[model samples]
Target chain A: MKKILVAAFMVLLGASWANAAGTAAGTQIQNSLTLDYEVGGINQTDINADDGNGFLVDNKNDVLVTTADVASVKVTPGSTAQVLTFTVKNEGNKVQDFILSVSDAGAAFSLTDNFNATSQSIFVESGTTPGYQSGEDTETYIDELAADGEKTVYVVASIPASQVNGDASIITLTAQVATGGTASSQGSATVNDTGADAEDTEQIVWADSAGETDAVEDGKHSDASAYEVQSASLTVTKGSCVIWDPANEGTNPKRIPGAVVRYTIQVANAAGAQDATSVVATDVLPGTVTYGVGGSGLTQIARVVTEVCSCTSPGTANTGNVSESTGTVTATYESPISASETQCAYFDVTIN
Target chain B: MKKGFLSILLIFAFSSIVYADVSIKSQSLQEKIINKQTKWVKATKVIPGTKIRYINTMSNNGTVMAQNLVITNAIPKHMLYVDKSAKCDGVCSITYSVDGKAFDVPAKLFVTENGKKRVAKALEYKAIRWIVQTLDANQSSSVQFDATLE
Candidate 1:
């Protein structure tokens, strides 16, 4: 019986030891397993924050993002069009939120973006977008996007295509997020005559930028001659093998490429007459390109100078009767943004 | 015969296109904008032992050329006593002046076609040759002279 008692004591001790050891082992396993702090070089996993949408930006000094885009806009030339696009995400860890805005101070103040439709589009200058600036645009808010949130704002700009004569502006897109928001990344878009190829009857009115130059040629194109004044237009394209000769001297019609290149053109005056009003010269340079200097006299080749006059003022700078022969009336033009190679610029000389 | 017909068709198509195409005309003034020299003249300042030069610039604001006309200038008498020059052929003429004074100046100036001058003072001398020339409408000539002042 005593031996039985001894065995019982040993069994109890063994049971206790086993329980203690098993508990220790379970605790060790729990400590050994942990949540990984990093994935794909992103440390956000460490914080394990909300807002499943999170991004890691390599460049923290300059980060310009288009938080929102105005899909619809109404534009008219010689007027102000302000579109709202915000730079949302600032990626730095700093608490203070930098202001986001745009301006055309660095770029030419005259050439602002024209949305063309009634819903005018705003032009942005440097800050986060093309029209580089640091100040807040009108109606711009959100000094600091919350660490995980974004700032929303709009861009407002004034561009008068007519009075300004080649008016344009740019949209500078920028973002000021919490951590090292921008590293050196800013975005920009060029402003142009939005109504360049409008099909509306009023389209010709906007083309008034031609002034009085085109008026006389339109009348002369009515007459018939050996080389009937066929349709005429000024156009441009990259240099071609047959025509791109810089050495060929003077306004080679083949249309050389430039932010502003000169284009000159002539057509057979088949039914050329003083009354012909279709003769036209139009300049079609890429809207992306701009003149290096003001009044550079570099314009589209297809543009015809127009002369408009009231009873008071002398005919506009280029206006004349069909019979009149102006030095370069209706012949010179500066190019605007062109759509395609065919639309590059062409005049249809209709034989009456 | 087939090849000939094809060639004729191609030519017709090309001619039609060319007829309607507005193009650069070789006769256009914009096309003639080559780096062509328009005119030149001598300096007005005369000095010895200095590099002499005529700073002549190309026409209109360095953008376009000025055309046609004539002008006359006389070498200062103080510099060229009785220099051999040319008579005005309705184009150019030159004069002389020993000193840059009104009375001592020559009554008439001579013209230099291929202007040539010799410095009486020194081989290294500068003479500001006073010059005059007429430019046709829309034409220009910018002539300047660099020399040490006497």
Candidate 2:
């Protein structure tokens, strides 16, 4: 009886030990085992409880993403201080700083002729500013842009009056991760060096796990936008005033047939940047009026006067003659008149 | 003894039938930018600055429901995972890893900087994992996330 009782006790202890071991093994399998399911060679999927194999994960460091809103601009000639707005978006995962610049497109502008295009003077301003200053401020420092954040920038270009029509310039905006560097002197009023003030300094977050240094991957992204200069419109107008008499100048001029009349042709340019070259004015006498050369029956006018009227001083007058064959009077100006400048030509005719 | 052996064989066969027939399929997509708007396109060849999305579908064809199904994916090289973009259809728990070895919630994941621990940012995440509590038989579920090519 005693031997049988001891054997039974041993059996119970053995079962308990076996149960404990099985429970521990099952827990281990659940925690660390990679479970794979295969259904009759048709479907297969695997899952790793620990970091072994299932999905591939990689950390991206030094990812600097930047883009400009406006790709190009067209500026009309005579447009004073036109503003080209661009929104610089920081799609990177960190805060970054950017510098702005404007340069002539050069070969990129695709100019066949030596246009002598004037370099555009540009100024940088934030979105809130009312006006842009024309000094050395061109760089913009973005203090802290969270991931997927964007800021609007205004590029104010002072289009030179000398800029010809169809001229083009390109503006390039480059963004660089402001890790550590001396602040540029030409930065905007709101932009300053990263470490200029101790209290205002932003913390630099490293991109890697070891944290030995910030992972600097492609930290600079640049985009260029082209701006074309539009052409200026030019126009001319002409009129005549009757002179009652050249010898006896009357206060009130009348439209009498025998009265000596002075034909005045005024050539004026519209408000534009282009100059009108080789301006010439011609007038033909009617059958009812005679050339003031003291003759009748299609006689020629001896001379006519043409001068620049809008200059500071009276321009030199040139003498022109009327053709007897065609009964036409012609006057040519020597120099080209710029926009808003006028030239005048006058000749006398007597009514029959 | 022969009868007992037959009963054990029968139980083993029944368990095998219950655990079989789960299928998983995966696909990749890219986002195209047109006129300042975003449209998704199927990814064949990816380029830098492109946003990519990965979709994984898990289907159960067995007669018994699947329990405690977990899906995990590694962030591909030259890609930055978008923050908080991972999702699943059923009740699940999502977690992220910075070094791919260890995983934790986004707020709890930490990285050492200047000899101090700081919460890891979204771009620092290297991997994502999702745990599904249960999937009914003959039903399917999906998980997805977005990343940007570096």
Candidate 3:
């Protein structure tokens, strides 16, 4: 009879050790003690008593937010769609929803925060695809995020045209704990359970530590990321060299009457994320000089100019439009002068 | 054989006349922030990961001393026993059980994992037993163990 009872107790012990996030709230941990003793060398009956009602497990609410980008996302000025990614993880012991928001007031990256991005929008990454997709990841706020579950969130914005190269816009993503259970909808923000502890019901407690902008136990967390402007910087310079003359042709040509001079206008852009487009260079010839002896008097080209104002390489000819009217030469280079590229406009004139 | 059985029944009845009465009672406690200080109070607001202390008091209420007093307690469900937290106020030997059927010292408890037998962790302990040599009349002793809610 005693062996059967002992075996039953062993079975109960094995069932209670199942792994979980924690014991569910309001679970009664009933326990009793069994005492066996012998008096005067005689075995006595066992004694047992009921321990006081066991305590209930309270609610633990915690969350973590971290920026997924190692560095600020590079964007060009006037970029329509730029993204900064973050991760929101539910560190609590139960399911929860998170209300998400983005703010321009945040910690800056290595670059100075000088501008604010426009049309800022938040998105929750869909599990179907990774990273930010314009039309794919459309969910704004997190819903029904399970314990230890994390979702990638994107802060999408547009870079204004006025924002120049090296300008940065910092964006902060904040997630506030909210009531969970419903799907496809935003839940109300959760307040920590307060007042006297109730043994029958699970009480909510804030267990999260501090994040970038949130205090400890505040049921919310925040992290910051940035978008830095990486626009093209273009510079233009014009130089002229004597080409031919009646007396000293192509050799130490003088700035005298009938001396022909070749003019070169160079437009160079530094290596950057954007390209300069619709580049037009114009030079007004003096009354002492006339348009080139050749037809049209203008030829648009491109070259790698190493020394300042020095043009030597016969670069590939550009498909730009060139026109000369009343001794003034205008050349519109091919559209979109790419980064780390130099384009030059060449025209010749004769001293009259 | 009938006469021998009758004599044994009489001896059992005589021993019952000089019996020792033993009683057991249990209590559960949890830590709470009361006023400005943290104190161990009756578990009122319990939650996951809360550390609970289960205490069992054993007392001898009769005129004779209770010999070989053994107190056994099952670690509560949904809880993990804390290592080295079992204690007894009197001179006693304490052992643990993983399955509640086989009790052994902490060093002797073993569990099989991946076809290999390894020493059981404190969290795997399911039951605790404490044996005291004797409990004198009108004397009470308590045994306690701490566990954290899973």
Candidate 4:
């Protein structure tokens, strides 16, 4: 009987040891990497979070460390041309760099207001330094992007208020690293305010305005940055643009949600000037366009008729749902715009 | 009688199996290929006066996103342009479009600081430079130029 008891005790001890070992491991396997997104007080529109734990969203923007992060863009037409805005926060390990660009996809869009397609280059980044130039133009940066940095750019597109129907456009933007750079932080979202309200279009005829245009992008340099302005901050003040008119809109305009309808875009300074010297009217097709007749105040830098926004702004996509073919986008500007001032754009599209 | 019953059961099983082969359903998510791009090689545009400067754009198809993207070009000559590149200095670079516009910039030419033909890398096409972006889903990006064309 004593020998039997001893054997039973030994068995019990062995079982207990096995149970303890399993408890130490808990549920998930040990020594494995897992990613989680962070939460709390995070803005769904603009939030910083790593997946929970070490998955860190840099500034904690709830964004994953992976390169597939994306952001949304919003373009609203105020009294001037239109107000295009978006916010970006650092959501990665290393310092981040951002670039925003756009292109005309095709006839997937139409203008709500009549605009000029002449004498313009939409300054799309942020119209100035400390801010991304917000117009339809070009600028480079040399500064190092610290991890989790955040910034926003606003573009003020100008059009001569003479543009009509059948004008389509697309825009693309890129965000990346300022250092060894990869398209990792590459994210994209689109905004549109094109075309007129049904009643407004039918009521007003020939109340046209010229369309505007612009571009954006980001990259890295091993040596010193070859750009003039690496980092930018935009400061905005009140300057009324020419009012938008629903009348005289395009004869046939594409229908897109949130498209930029009639807008009055204006800027004090567009170029690198502190006093706000360079400002031009620009247009972007919500999609494809067909009827195109070049204008003087605008330059047809791109006559893309494909379904996607053909302009190569950095991101995961060119034009999301834009039908890249069959339409036109126009841009215009103001040197003085007071009868005495003269402006000339490159040319217009004669859709093939 | 028992043997006959076993034969009938066997036959029924065989027939069912044959029917399954004839009526199996297939599941697949198929999207039509729009613009398809083939192979593409890019060189850093660095040469100052080369009239024919290279521009970086999407490969082959104007709209289709590239799949199984590959880089057949060599280093420096076949790499993205990077200043102080540890691998290929002066030879590595990239290009970008202004507002997505397809404009021709200046040409790029790679020259070793030591003034020696880089036989070590065996880069292709005079060994300028290039890079490959592993795009996801419908992702896209751009390459910047170093030199303008003639």
Best by TM-score: 3
lDDT of 1 by residue, A128-167 (tens): 5444233533333344333333444555544444422222
**Span of ten consecutive residues with least summed lDDT in model 2 chain A:** A1-10
Ranking by lDDT: 3, 2, 1, 4
Superposition error at A66 for model 1 (Å): 4.4
Over A1-352, each residue of candidate 4 has an lDDT whose tens digit, in order, gives 0010000000111111111101110011001111111112121121111111111001111111111113212221222444334344433333334444333221112322222222223232433454433343343321233434444433334433332112212232233333324443433221121233221111111111112221221121010000011111222221111111223224333233211122222223233322212333344543432323322122223221212121212123212111223333233333332212222232223222
Lowest lDDT block of 10, candidate 1 chain A: A25-34
**Candidate 3: C-alpha lDDT:** 0.77
The TM-scores of all predictions, comma-separated, are 0.19, 0.35, 0.81, 0.19
Q: Give per-candidate clash totals.
A: 137, 6, 6, 181
Query: How much is B121 displaced in model 1, in angstroms?
Result: 92
In DockQ terms, which candidate is top?
3
Model 1 bad stretches (over 4 Å): A1-76, A94-96, A105-139, A163-167, A171-352, B1-150
Q: What interface RMSD does each of the candidate structures achieve?
A: 50.5, 21.0, 3.0, 31.8
lDDT of 2 at A123: 41
What's model 3's lDDT at A295? 33
Off by over 4 Å in 4: A1-81, A106-143, A165-170, A180-352, B1-150
- Residue A14 in model 3: shift from native, Å? 18
Pick by DockQ: 2 or 4, better one: 2
> Model 2 over residues B1-150: C-alpha lDDT tens digits?
999999999999988776645666665666666599986655533323446677777788877777666565667544578988999996889888887767789989999999999999998887777777767789999888887655
| Superior by TM-score: candidate 2 or candidate 3 | 3
Highest-lDDT candidate: 3
* Poorest 10 consecutive residues by lDDT, candidate 3 chain A: A7-16
